[model samples]
Target: MSKFMVLVKQLYKQKVSAKSFILTTLLYLVVLAGIMYWSEIRDLIFSGDADTIAVVNETNFDVSEVLQNTDDYEYEYVTAGEVAEKLKDGDYYAAFTLTDADGKLAAKIESYDPLPLNDQQSFQGMLSQAGQIYAMSQLDLSPEQQQLLLSSEPIITLNSINEAAADGKSADEKMAGVWISYAIGIIIYIFVATYLSIITTDVASEKGSRALEMLLVSVKPEIHFRSKIVGVFLVALTQFIILFGGLLLLLRFSDGGNKWSIVTNLLDSMSIGYFLYVMGFLFLTIFMYLIIGALFGSLVSKVEEAGQVMMPAMMLTLVGFYVMLTGMGNPDTMLIKVFSYIPFTSGMVMPMRLGATDISAIEPIISFGLLLGTVLALYFLSLSFYKRSVLTYSSGGIIEKMKTVFKVTT
Candidate 1:
């Protein structure tokens, strides 16, 4: 326990400066502000009523009679000869003209201002109802029958095999999925950026300050290298654990007994099995990324060279995110199923598809096992590189480095 505490303390001491902590905190604060701003705007946009629109009745058609019966929008009727001119003069936000020809009704709405989407839809529905009512009256139907014909009947049958459900999720549910994807994406992004950048800076700073010479005397290169990798990995994992726990707590209590906050809906809708699967994938992927990133960091002599060395890991990240994007629509396809089994991209792809569709639990478990295996193999391989490259710096492909690490000489 003491040894573990010592290692953790050493790791935390490296980046515990006031400036770094403050900067990180400020960045999160700014992000929170942005999220709040977006919510305010969304509420404002969706909460408004459709603007009051006027109708002109010139063909002895009671446009008011037809419009008033509909619940979609409020309309005022004016007895005017030049309806188009009246609409253009801005007495109303919009004006719909009513005309009957050959026992059929036709309607058109002219707007002086930009029409809201809901308003446009309501206007179109009003026109349809007007046509139906006029047509029914010509057939000598009573008012009750006309009203019945105008109203839509509720259907009990709902059929959608996840594909149709792709678009049918309510705004809150859709927003939740989108927010979750983005939240996960951001977690991956920050983990990679922080740990990888930390390692690169550590290598370059040690090399620059000539500290490697003094530190190399007591500790074997492999021990020092493993300690650094393990230390940073542990730090990242700890921060992730802390953040995840905090987020979970926040999610649990976010509703404030309102029963309708975004955080509550997210937790309520998520299945236990699905939650476990996502957590497993996240943990496995972070383990793999930390090891791979540490290896990339160790191979470079200076921080400037770290980016070039880290290309493979970066490429893996890109592929993982790209596969996630592609898997959005056809989660059940054979190609998607196969991709979910692969180690590198599966972390991002599989969870996203599962969030969007129904994926069997067995497949995720198998994929998780593969990812763990890959992490182990990569960690050992990275340890070899760290041993060879920490003291000795050279420019070569990763394949050539592999030969040197294994002591293969021709």
Candidate 2:
């Protein structure tokens, strides 16, 4: 046990101190932080540069009150003839002419640059409201009635019928949970795939260099294998902490008034219990994949065969991710319910169901139990295979190597 601990510590330090590991951790932190704060960064860079639009009113209708004005755009009123010149000279991002067309309003927008969809929709809404007012006036309705007609109805509030009603979580809370689950699923897929590859490559490299032979002389294969798993997990955990910790700090220090604080909002919506459960499931899932990775890594004789050996685990992870993504749209489906109980997919699907719907306590308990049992079974099975085949060298394809391992175990 002492020897295993020493080996694990050495391997962990070796991995964490590597130049590639340091560079990749920093790069991922930067990339994740950039993605989370892209809107804020864009706003800072383009703060004062709002898109300007030139409006040419050919009709006598006063529809200026219906137009939207905000930081995203500025409207300049001009004559019909000035529209073409302004647009041609690129003085404005776009020019639009509003005229009378068969007793209704029509607008033609011309631009040096393509208008954004949101801007186009806003203009369309303005024109539609103007037409409605004109039509109401033609009906001989009083100003009060016209005003009443133009006013919108009260918004209908929707409440969840699930057990979360007792918890008093709002719609925003549930939506935030859904987003968190999707993000968790995606992160798990990416991290598992990346770390699994790293584990397989590391093991294969050690084997290729005949370092495993010398290491095995002093330590049993089981201790060496388990120590490597723990060491790789520590390396991955350190990277995870660095990336997420930097993001948390960035969110903490960022401008509170910014509208792009999605990460903060998601974190706020998660309760302590939910957060702990997510972390628990996430760790279990990672450890399971790491064990499977180590098992396959032990089978490959050359570093180049690492990818081929890890393909099965990669495929399983991809399937789980795909199911989680597609299942989110319909959580109550029978197929998704079945998938939520599956050990290989439970880590991704169960969290999603818990977030998007109301699940009974028993459901998560059963799913978690199944997942725990599966991990344990895979761990023992992988250890058995590793003990039987770690030292064996075979210059064959993945299938042939797998056959050899099974033959030896048998």
Candidate 3:
């Protein structure tokens, strides 16, 4: 047991200290942080010099005053003559004219280049609101009438007969749930495939060389095998810790401007318990795949064959990923419910159901128990014939050699 611990520690340090490992971890951290704070980064890169929008108000009221300035456009009230001169000299991004046309308010925009779709949409929405506000002010209605007209809610109320559909999850919340499920499934699928490749290569390279045999003389092959798996798992965990740690620090320090807060609020809707359970399940799922990768590596006689043996694991995870997509459409399906208890497929499917559905509270626990049991079963099974897998060097396909190993061990 003490030797196992020592071996595990050595393996961890050796891999973690590798230049490639450190570079990869740092690169992942930088990329994730960049994605999370993309808006801020965009502002830093593109702000400080906003294009001026020369406003020509030929109407009685001020249109520019009613509209808010954005980082992309700064409003500058100018004369009709000044609008032409400023635009000619490239001092203005565009000219916005507000005038009375056909006895009603009208607006027009002229620019050197065609405006972007987003900018056009923004201008139209805000100008429409400004027109409404001006028209409202000109009316000789009572204060109560104005208040009634300004009420944000629809005049016709919508009440669902089904209470569960209206369980405080807004349309936005449900949308967020769908996207979150997608991210979870993709993360599991990609991470499992990526780290599985890493583990197989690590094992196959050593097993293909004389070093594995010398190491087996000091330690039992099974213990050595598990130590390597655990080590690789730790490497994966370290990368996640750095990535999530940076996220936590950002959440702690940054004000999370308007766009970022919307995303954070969507995440905040879930209970702490759900996050904890999903994280544990994700860890178990990855570790289980890593174990399988190690086994595949032990079976391969050549170091280069490590990547070739991942077809089975990839196909199984792909099936689970598809189930997750199906769950996003309808979580109450029998397909999702049944697969949630299946160890191989549950990693992605169960998380989708938990976040998207309000199923019986005990169901997740039961599913988790099944998954935990499967992981332990696989671990012990791997320990039994791992020595045979590493020692035998017969040349064949992964399954053929694996069958020979089990055949001899049994």
**Which prediction has more favorable lDDT, 1 or 2?**
2
| lDDT scores of the candidates, listed in order | 0.65, 0.81, 0.80
Q: List the residue pairs that clash in candidate 2.
A: none
Q: Model 3, stretches more than 4 Å misplaced?
A: 35-40, 54-62, 77-91, 94-151, 154-191, 256-268, 315-342, 394-410
Clashing residue pairs, candidate 3? none
Q: Tell me the TM-score of each prediction against the true structure.
A: 0.68, 0.85, 0.76
TM-score winner = 2
Clashes of 1: 0
| Candidate 2 local distance difference test against the native | 0.81
Worst 10 residues of 2 by lDDT: 163-172
Tell me the TM-score of model 1: 0.68
Candidate 1: 10-residue stretch with minimal lDDT: 164-173
Residue-by-residue lDDT tens digits, candidate 1, 285-404? 777776676666665566677667677777777777766666554545676677778887777767765665555556677888898888888888767666666665555776665556
Q: Each candidate: how many clashes?
A: 0, 0, 0
Candidate ranking under lDDT, highest first, comes to 2, 3, 1
Compared with the true structure, model 2 gives a TM-score of: 0.85
Cα misplacement distance, residue 178 of candidate 1 (Å): 8.1
